[model samples]
Target: MQQNLDYQHLKAQIKNWALEIGFQQAGISDVNLNEAGKHLNNWLQKQYHGDMEYMARHGEKRYIPKQLIPDTLSIISVRLDYMPAHLTPYESLTIQSNKAAISRYALGRDYHKVIRSKLKKLAQKITEEIGDFGHRVFTDSAPVMEKAIAEKAGLGWIGKHSNLLNSKAGSYFFLGEIYTDLPLEPDQKQGFHCGSCTQCIQDCPTDAIVAPFQVDARRCISYLTIENKGPIPVEFRQAIGNRIYGCDDCQVVCPWNKFTHTTHELDFQPRNDLDDIQLLELFNWTENEFLNKTQGSPIRRIGYEAWQRNLAVGIGNIKTNEKTKQKIIATLKAKLDESSDLVKEHINWALNQFQ
Candidate 1:
């Protein structure tokens, strides 16, 4: 009974320390993700994951925390808001065909590094208090069901858009987890509050949200622009619009996001004017320029080739004057000799858009 009381006190302390360490919210959850496992199997069975085979590689280990880390009894889930303040509004950028609409969360340094570093510090603090303990920290780097775990941890509900939605903070945040052997008392999960809203479904440019609480990654612009490596299908090119990195239409359309607080983290501030840059300017970048610009940013993970491919798609969808059209066409033609077959194909498609 004394040990139980100790754990309860530790849980409260953990939450307090999490806020001090820059996390907006933190909650504990016992590791029983059976329902989430079922949902994963169903989503994978439908092949909605596209070429992200890593999603299917982990099998049951993703949902079974103890199986992944033996003796794990509780998980500490933390939320950090990532929306940078005072940038060009997302809706305004999306409508400007010449401007690239990079997702709000990825405008700055890689969030995986930021959140992972903070989580390790939280774990270190725990160690300082209770001595050494078995614990593992995870950001989006692993195959963890982050949204599901966050929902179960009482951070928020998994909304119809498949992003965690908090009534107070909205969905523009990152989630990190610390799986531990500590027997902390779990917080109560939040109730689902999406109700009859289908705004996210209607707003998706590619109809990626096939149904409430389900998204087909093959049709998701974020997956197409970031995760996909090959030539983009001709069908979805126009709908992709000017989003050169990832899509944010669903989150932007969600009513809850109106309550979102801009992040104070300077690391999340826009770099290279990514939040509102021109497609033509990005398309003209040489490989070295791409590397130099995207260094230390999450956009770098997709590499230069995919970056060009996405920019080509965005440029193709631009509505411009004859002079601008010729300039874009000349740029596309100049890269033809250097581009790989995949990029060449996209460039050709982009050039054809002017005709």
Candidate 2:
């Protein structure tokens, strides 16, 4: 059965099915990530990955597709635009400091679940046409160098901020992968188009992008708020502003974002008015309320304590009236006594900002 298959034609059919099933673009790539592996080693040696030990823990499995899944000859990479049609812009949210500025990706459902489900469907479609093929699907789930794979697959180029950038879709999307034993022809890789843009580097609130392609995760607000699980370093707290979940400063300022396509995925739309709500309103959520509201959303993974800690920092950064400041202080004081040590520390820091 495999001997008679037209692998190149099959690749084209797979991409078409991916588009019909909701992916914005799909491409294939040979499994040679040696260059990416070298870069990863250098970044890991400098401890740029911060507390993300899993990044380095995977050994060569991340860069070597065959080691992760033997007999994998090609990788199918797909992009799904996630930006909803309407939301308060990040620029406006920054000035309206009372409102939370979550990374737009998290305003809707978790991309991991959304993309994984679609990838599985894509794999199933391939099996129906080509018979049972060896394949595995992933979206940030394991040791996978998805960005490098996507770039190699010609979906986009890895921009200065280290996020994959498409000339037409910008960086406002998610990537998923399907590794298979089929000998699909690889697409031509895209050339880097960010010739002289320094906007993303200069505008980063915490200067996370230390260099053009290097991001120090320790100084990244997305990492501080979502991954750190401790008190955000005092130095970066004020700069964090009202971003309670993940940050989007780099993507927000990218010149290429002007061409970004808004998503039609209803699951990517904002929920609970999170896209345009006040920090105090989010800060006021009880543990149960936080859990209930963020159910199936990416924000829920950080848990309620970190949620409070992030909101307290956001409230402290609020540029509002004296009456509002007093109310914010009173609110922090109310939670300080009963909160966990981590939350109390951030609440205390918030009260100090008022003082």
Candidate 3:
């Protein structure tokens, strides 16, 4: 019982310290995640996870906190607002027609690095106060179900868009966790506030949301462009618009996002006028240029062939005019002879788009 008291005290101090470290809010929850496990299993059984085989690989280890981290008794979930204030998604979506739209989260330094650093610091601080701890920190690494844990920790409910929705902070934040042996008193779980609003479901361009609180990742733009390795399915091609990276349409249409606090992180701001660059310009980038420009950026992982493939789709979606059409067609044709079949197939499709 005395050890429990120590854990509770440490929990209080940690929450306060988390805010000092630039997190907007922090809360603790017990290790149990049975309810979330069931939902995830059902989603997977339906094959809604698509090409993300990692989701099914972990099995029950993902929900049972102690299984992932032995000696864990509670999870300390933290949220860092990343919206970067007043830079409304609505404005960005409308600012340019031919621009390739990337998700807001990818706009900064990768959250995996940023949030992991803060989580590790928080765990270290706990050791200084409580002598020692058995813990592991995570930032979107592994098979952790962050939205489920965040809801249990009183952070927010996962919204209809499948993003965690906080009434005060909205869903524009990144979540990180620290699994610890501390028996901290858990925070009361947050309630769903999405109510009757169907804005996100109605607004998805690809209709990826099959129903409230559910998303078919196969149709999700983010997964299609970033996760899928080969050709993008032809059915959804035109609906993809000019988005060559990740997509942000669901968040853009959410009314609650109006309250989202913009991020102050410099790493997330637009680079090389990326926020408004034309699709042809990105498609024209040499492989070496792609390497140098996207060195530390999230867009780098898709590799040169996939990068050109996605860009070709964007170019195909653009309005075809004499000069613009010739330039786009010429760009595709120039590299077709040497490019991979994936890039060549997209180039062929793009040429067909021209008059």
Query: What is the C-alpha lDDT profile of model 3 across 1-355, one tens digit per residue?
Result: 1253566667789999999888999998888899999999999999999988989999989988777888988889999987654443434653455677777777656778888888988887787776677788988888788889999999998898989988887888999999887778899988888899998899787899999878999998889999999899988888887888878888877888877887777777766666657777888789999888887777888899888988888878886558767777788788888889999998888778775
- Which has the better lDDT: candidate 1, or candidate 3? 1
Query: TM-scores for all candidates?
Result: 0.98, 0.99, 0.95
TM-score, candidate number 3: 0.95
Query: Which candidate, 1 or 3, would have the higher TM-score against the true structure?
Result: 1
Per-residue accuracy of model 1 over 1-355 as CA lDDT, tens digit each: 1233488788999999999999999998889999999999999999999998989999988999887888899899999999988999999999999999999989999999999999999999998888888899999877678888888889999999999999999999999999998888889999998999999999899999999989999999999999998888999999999999899999999999998989999999999988888888888888999999989999999999999999888888999999988988998899899998888999899989999
Off by over 4 Å in 3: 1-5, 85-95
- The candidate scoring highest on TM-score is 2
Ranking of predictions according to TM-score:
2, 1, 3
Candidate 2 residue pairs in backbone clash: none
**Candidate 2 residues 97-216, lDDT tens each?**
888898899999988999999999999999889789899999989899999999999999999999999998899999999999988899999999999989999999999999999999
lDDT of candidate 2?
Answer: 0.92
